[model samples]
Target: MVHLSRMCTLVALLVALAGCASAPEPQGNSEILNLQAEAEYAYQLALLDQAETLYLEILRSIPNYAPAWFRLGNIYSRTGRLDAAILAFERCVELEPENQKALYNMALVRLKQSHQIISLARRQNGVDPQVQRQIDGLYQALLRLQQHTPTDSN
Candidate 1:
């Protein structure tokens, strides 16, 4: 009887351990959606810094969150972090190839960076070759985007 009881107890313990060992599927999309909503509300309230932080947190949670990436790019651009903004925009484009907003923002960010580079070149005695090359490339890319982007002035 004692042996049978020990066997039953071992079976119960194994079942409990198996249950505990199972991993839960992540609800990444839903959590990111909630974070995005909160970020939007913060932006609407003029809490720019808070919105930026929340957006960054969302990216940290879901690296491939395309909308969060696009928004972060916008926030970074507004805060004058042009390089980071460009990178975030690139990530958004990579994740969502059909995202026109990301593509447009990327073009805009590149244009801003190019202008900054030109200003720096004028201020310095000698322009850095690498910087000049980057600026030229960015300018060309921006022009191409502008040419391709549709106008809706009417």
Candidate 2:
């Protein structure tokens, strides 16, 4: 049953990402920027595997490149690799704690996976409740992040 459900999810995910557009580019070091163009192009062209590989290679050399991590997360999300997406987004947030987009994406991925986690947990052979609670925390954080900041009233 789980396998069938996963395959159906995979098909739906693929259709949704068939023409998915690339996310915003992050400004990185000049050396990193030099390598980013090809990866970005691959992403824009929806060559997800190629884009992922390129992004991972960049991270290997510059693990602190938050943009690469964010982009990799986006790619993973589009391709239905939710766990990988969460990891990439988490890395992006860790490197750039104030990046709203990374925060949002991390929350989004966690939200999507939370449904699965909760449902599976309720099915008698479920996962630990702590996982569900952690996702709830992330969701709350995302909501706090999306709150509007007061602008100058002058």
Q: Which predicted model would earn the best lDDT? A: 1
Worst 10 residues of 1 by lDDT: 12-21
The regions of model 2 sitting more than 4 angstroms off are: 1-34, 121-154
Residue pairs in candidate 1 whose N, alpha carbon or C atoms collide under 3 angstroms: none
Query: 75-107 in candidate 2: lDDT tens per residue?
Result: 988788999988888987787676667667777
lDDT of 1 by residue, 26-101 (tens): 4554465667679979876768799989988976865666666777788888788989988888997787676666
Model 1 TM-score (2 dp): 0.59
| TM-score of each predicted structure versus truth | 0.59, 0.57
Pairs with backbone N, CA or C atoms under 3 Å apart (clashes), candidate 2: 121-126
lDDT of each: 0.68, 0.67
Q: Quote the lDDT for 20 in model 1.
A: 41
